[model samples]
Target chain A: MRKNRSPKPPEPCLLTECMQVIAGAWAPNVIWSLRAGPRRFNELKTDIPPVSSKVLSARLSELEERGVLVRHVRPTSPPSVEYELTALGEELIPALEAIVEVGHKLKQLRGYEPASEAAE
Target chain B: MRKNRSPKPPEPCLLTECMQVIAGAWAPNVIWSLRAGPRRFNELKTDIPPVSSKVLSARLSELEERGVLVRHVRPTSPPSVEYELTALGEELIPALEAIVEVGHKLKQLRGYEPASEAAE
Candidate 1:
């Protein structure tokens, strides 16, 4: 018996289309950071250490244009801007979670140590 | 009340770790092709049109090195070469399936036409 997922193969175009959504430096990281809740600009940068403000700003704009996320100008005294995932953006979390699960296993298989729990 | 997957955010390194596993030009395509079953060199090339032979060969070698897939030299009359996913590679299928699912929706959401059923 074959151990494949489906009897027919998946179309390559589908994968390419989806990869482009998450493609780019720290794009996934940006999305992942917002997985928990809406985050302000500084919060996002803090969650993803070592990401320069310029690149982070650029990625936020790109994601917003892609409709994966939305920017809200909060009515705070200083008018804080927060980013949150759109419905489509929320759907990508499971896919990313699955990838993280596999990547953890792959890292151990390849003899690389997994990083300690960081979200605590 | 947040509409997020977890109360705690996912570790960024985990996503990065997994992304690296599928990183590189056409690497996901290589893995996606092998998802259905093992494929010969020419079969793979045909599956993904416009991919240069040099790039495809490099991808296979890299995937092999990363423990994602294995290459077998079939002891046929001319010794055919074939590539297939390993256990770890197989684990990535669901993640990719998720991606393809989101991608299909993303294409439509972005007002782009989805390619007609090609695998039918």
Candidate 2:
């Protein structure tokens, strides 16, 4: 007699959702800068050069909505706002670190060095 | 007297490079499917529904060029080709796993269930 077997449950495509969070061109750079600490909008703009003010604001809002980052409004003559990573966002660091490791390995295999390093 | 201090060397942005590999919309899905084993072009297309033939072929070629996957051509009456992950590609699995874990947490926090589960 054949024993009955239950079909395996369909695993949700979690990686796809995660990738959506970081798919923005400047999302990783923004997250990387915030790893040091929280920053005001202007500070973030300064830290991540080449990103326009409009785009930066948009990405920040997107991250906040996704729960990856939090927006805190400070009470002052002019209310100051700062953005920082949430617990959920912090959880992404290890994965980012792993990606970095794999990326370095790929670069090494391809014999492609960063321009700054090449200049040095 | 101030002691001489060597400047910290600039670290390369490995995450950016890694992101380039998976930047394509279908990249993660393709990589995830390949995790099981090698597959032919047609097999991949079938596995990843909704992707057009042109886009799928481009993604395959791009992945192969990035050193993430290898394309093997088998000699037969009609040559058969299969694509499989390289060691570097295999290295990305852990990172992907981590991302998936974080994604699940995010989705749970949002109280959003997948459509399949919602149907049940």
Candidate 3:
């Protein structure tokens, strides 16, 4: 005979945890920059100019801890460290794209040029 | 003849602006809560219990200012006010769904039960 299963309790709030991972001035920018590809610490710093090295490092570490990013160290002549989005992190790109699209739409509605059109 | 147009400068980063909109402890939850339908202030408070009244009001006002939600004051005895997602805000639901999916996946990888599965 098949056994009946009891309903499970709701999992601890993952949405709030995900939001915490992305909440911060530098975390989003860092994640956005990495969407193209992995980058060294210096490269990330250069790509996101307004962020200081200190803040960037902190954000990177936080993201890594959250499993959104993975750190790699290359054993070359000099050891080089790089950071890239994990599979979980890649999953967030579509969401970010959607957010960007909506943001552009809002800007257009408010009489500002949409970002994509403004890039034309 | 069509005029030759120079490529326009990249519009001020919309991604960052969008990130700013969703980046907060309560903002994502508030946005997610409205996904089903509009909610009055008290309704929202009950939906997201951990948030205090003062913080919820502040977040709702901030979301309204950011154009993510619209506040409608009902013409009633007590003048009930309801908050609903704008078109732009509705656009964010898919993104939030994607985030939640990834969040669940990450939780599973970490040996925690996925939220949906746990709810079953």
Candidate 4:
């Protein structure tokens, strides 16, 4: 039998660490879905239709490990689980919004009138 | 033999697409390093010491593919290449800075005096 041992954690590089925390292939989609409110696993799966169940689960675990999202499991007849951003995660909104702002800028710079007045 | 066909590009989600462009393993480090000015490939490799040559190359290719970073080749005797962020990529700084700001806030909320006043 092979021993399943975790490799030593990489010494988190400052900037890369932050990006990795937010940059999972499906992470931004997960966070954006949660931005509306807390969600169940199924709800998130629906929000990101193309993500496979395995990929969604892995992304959630990664986000949870980074302390970006909280997972709550309720004790009941049947288990119910939900996920939401912690205060730290909520704080990331500005950064996400900033990215959107840049996208809007790029759009406008390409000669399209900005569609969203709120971005500026 | 397995064909070297590239995977179909993921349908770019709005926010996820932007994050993925900047969220590469060593991408932020490369961007931050370039923020000082343009840099050669060797300089970037040195800036991110922990990243393997293959990983760095892959990340560079991904960023270039996304049009975030530009790669230049010089036909000198020794051959030279340099990288710099396109205007759109440089525009991502505000978002990165916002993440650092949130980190500083998290640090303070955890009861350590914020070390950086510039964040606020």
Model 4 lDDT tens row, B1-120: 222122322333656656655766777777777765677777777667887889888988777766667899999877878888877668777776766666555554435322223343
Q: Against the true structure, whose TM-score is highest?
A: 1
B118: Cα error in model 3, Å: 22
**Model 3, runs deviating above 4 Å:** A1-14, A75-79, A112-120, B1-12, B75-78, B112-120
Per-residue accuracy of model 2 over B1-120 as CA lDDT, tens digit each: 222122211343667677777768688777877776787777777666777999988998878777778899999667878889877778777777777777777676666422222332
* Rank by TM-score (best first): 1, 2, 3, 4
Rank ordering of all candidates by DockQ, starting from the highest: 1, 2, 3, 4
Evaluated at residue A5, the lDDT of candidate 2 is 25
DockQ of each: 0.39, 0.31, 0.26, 0.16
TM-score winner, 1 or 3: 1
Off by over 4 Å in 2: A1-12, A75-79, A112-120, B1-12, B75-79, B112-120
User: How close is each model in CA RMSD to the real structure?
Assistant: 7.7, 7.8, 10.2, 13.6
- Model 4 regions more than 4 Å off: A1-13, A75-78, A107-120, B1-12, B75-77, B106-120
> Which candidate, 3 or 4, has the higher DockQ?
3
For candidate 3, lDDT tens digit of each residue in B37-87? 777887777667799999998998878876788999999888889899987
A14 in model 3: Cα distance from truth in Å? 4.1
| Tens-digit per-residue lDDT, A79-98, candidate 1 | 98999998778878888888
What 10-residue stretch in candidate 3 chain A is worst by lDDT? A1-10
TM-score of each: 0.78, 0.75, 0.74, 0.71
What interface RMSD does every candidate have? Answer: 6.2, 7.6, 9.1, 13.4
Chain A TM-score vs. truth, each candidate: 0.82, 0.73, 0.74, 0.71
